[model samples]
Target: MSSLLGSKEATNRSFRSIADLTVLGLLTLLLAALPLGASGYVLYVVNLLMVYVVLSLGMHLAIGETGQFTLSHTAFFGIGIYTAGLVNNHWHFPFPVSILASAAVAALVGWVIGVLALRMRDIYLALATFAFGEAMQWVLLNWESVTRGANGLRFRAATLGELQLVSDLLAYPFVVAIAALMMALTFAITRSRLGLAFRAVRESDMAAVAMGINARAIKVTSFVLSAAFAGVAGGMYTLFTSFIHPESLGFETTVMVLTMVVVGGLGSVRGAVAGAIIVGLISELLRQAPSYQEIIYGVILMLFMMFLPKGLASLVNGRVALKKGCAS
Candidate 1:
């Protein structure tokens, strides 16, 4: 029985590795090929989708992995954007430095929210995070002295030594590279022992604690990881785009990313990536029709929830399971 179980585990690991490589290979190929003849608008849209991908991946870590219903992703994202943009605006350092600073600052703020999350659960935890998100947006809106208030903050082009990212075409490669890196990192984290602890705690903190998993620490770590991803994503945004508004970092943005994670399958990394791209494109396409956008988006959400609550990942899983059963 032990040998059989070990064999089964090994097979599953192989299957997972193949699936991850297939997804990453496809995504990398798709993004990599876009630069050949893609227009500026196409480049911009893809860059924005990459940012959404990172944000959704982060959301998955908290709500999907650790089962923490924190709504502070947008807040962390805003923290990253302002931090990266402001640092670039004021300093002459390389843009990578500014982006790293953004990630550090966002992670620090996320840590505070994570500590606060220890005392709460479910809706209360979500509400607290959401409230914090709102407060941060307010700061971006009213802090005219530094943030330039409601007018929006526009910074200069990002630089790396002598190279300046003055156009979307120039920035596309870096954005794609970073997004790919984040996607691979997410997959790596999910397969690690730390990820095992995250899901264990998600199942039940009591059970995780019994197994010596340090549930509290796991929860905090999930939040930190999520925030850092959002921070990096915000930095990526600064690579192609120079201006940001508080309106762009509001609760609605969080909801959109949460939708991508949920619609893709909460705990599935492939689901997160695929969901972000598919659903984000739909959202972007609908921007031209402002009046019916919300209505259409609402209908799509309802349809998915009613018919495919487990998300697109479940469909793939079902097919894989069926094949295995047939072979057996």
Candidate 2:
């Protein structure tokens, strides 16, 4: 009976996995075909959605998997944007090179923040990171020489050799590819031994240490990796956007990413992706109604929190389990 039950359970899981992959494949096909018939505005929105997906995934790594409350994600994202934008604007380097430079610069800054995190936890860590984010915003706003201060920094078109990407359609393919790569990387990391260590640390650092895991190292590595993800998202942003303002890289942006991760189902990868897409679309749609936007957005969030606290994934999982139970 035990073996029979185990086999049945495995079969159910296999079916669920297959269903998920089928859905994902269909979505990818649809998205790939979008540019063929869609308007430039549609492609632009999709590209922006992909960037949010990457950004939310980064937040998920730090807060959900590693159990770190990091409020400085936008700061690292800003670091990436500025780094990539400046490099491309000055040298007209290829997009790949600029993206890599952005990731490295953001990772380096993340390391410093991670070291600071080692000495604090909970609210103290949150406050410290929040302060750091605000400080970075200030620097971006006041540093008129490099960031162009309040006037914003505009970049020349990103290019590949002689092919200049002058429109959203031109950049869409690269944006989608990079976002897919980040998603795959996130999945791989979450399924590895290091991912187990991250979960263990999240559950109990003391217990993880007792089990011979280097809790401190895992924490710091999480920060670094998360920041790198945000950096890549920023790099992706520069691919399509011509101008970036310092005002856009502040607490409000961080809050939006946090909302994406939390509303998507905290630690679940599917949740993060779905949340980003859904929220991104809603945000874009709401732009048409500027006056009621905040009110409607807040109400939707409040309803979600009150009704589906565990997130959209939980609601879907609940239905799946219910069906299984009914079948049994």
Candidate 3:
């Protein structure tokens, strides 16, 4: 009996390993083929999807993993874009430098918000963050000298010494690479001690505190990390696009990201990425039917919540588990 159990466990692991490799191989093939045959518009949409992936991952880190409800991600994203764009426009710094600066600024602001937010919980925290997001949008719209107000700010093409990325096709590689790096980083975080602490806090702050985890510190760290992710995503935006507008970085944007995270499966790294891609594509498609977009989007979200509250990731995992059970 013992030998049989051991054999089964080994077989399960082997199957899982094979499945993981297969998925990775398919993803690599698809990404490679896309640039070769995809249209410019398709590349643009894919680049935007990459940015959404990073943004949703950040949202996942804060709300899903750390159990902190924050609605200010769009604010951090806008900050990154404007800050990095301004620096790049004036100083002509390389993409790396500007991206880092954007992340740093967003992280710093996030730290301040996190420290203050420690005083609030649940709905209060959500409301506070929402208010902050709105306030930031106002600042972006009214601050003519800095954000160029309603006129919007245009970015000169991003460059690396001699090579300038003036088009989405030229920027696609870098954008995809950055998104992949963030996804890997997020996976690493989820496997580390910090990730364990985040889960603990999410499960129950009191219980986590009893385990000697500094709940406040962990929460703050999650906020900072999430904000940095959003900032980097914003930097990625500047790489592919030429314009930044306050209207695009507002409450609706936050809601879109929140829906992606929730529909993808809250607290799941894979879910976040999947949700971003799926929803991003849907949103792009909805552009053709602007009159029915909101209604359709809302209905889809409602259906998911009603039937798959655990999100799409749960459905995939359920299928995998059923297959393993059959094998056993």
Best by lDDT: 3
lDDT of 2: 0.90
Root-mean-square deviation (CA) per prediction: 1.9, 1.7, 1.7
lDDT of 2 by residue, 1-328 (tens): 8887788788889998999899989989998899999999999999999999999999889988999988999999999999999999899999999999999999999999899775799999999999999999999999999999999999988999998989999999999999999999999999999999999999999999999999999999999999999999999999999999998897777867777877898778899999988888877887777566556656766877788877888988889888778756
**How many clashing pairs per prediction, in order?**
0, 0, 0
TM-score of 2: 0.95
TM-score of every model versus the real structure: 0.94, 0.95, 0.95
Give all candidates' CA lDDT scores.
0.88, 0.90, 0.92
Q: After superposition, which runs of candidate 2 have C-alpha atoms over 4 Å from their true positions?
A: 288-302
Clashing pairs in 2: none
| lDDT at position 133, candidate 1 | 92
lDDT per residue (tens digit) for residues 228-302 in model 3: 999999999999999998988877688788889989998788899999999888889878776676566678778
Lowest summed lDDT across 10 adjacent residues in model 1 is found at 290-299
**Whole-structure CA lDDT of model 1:** 0.88
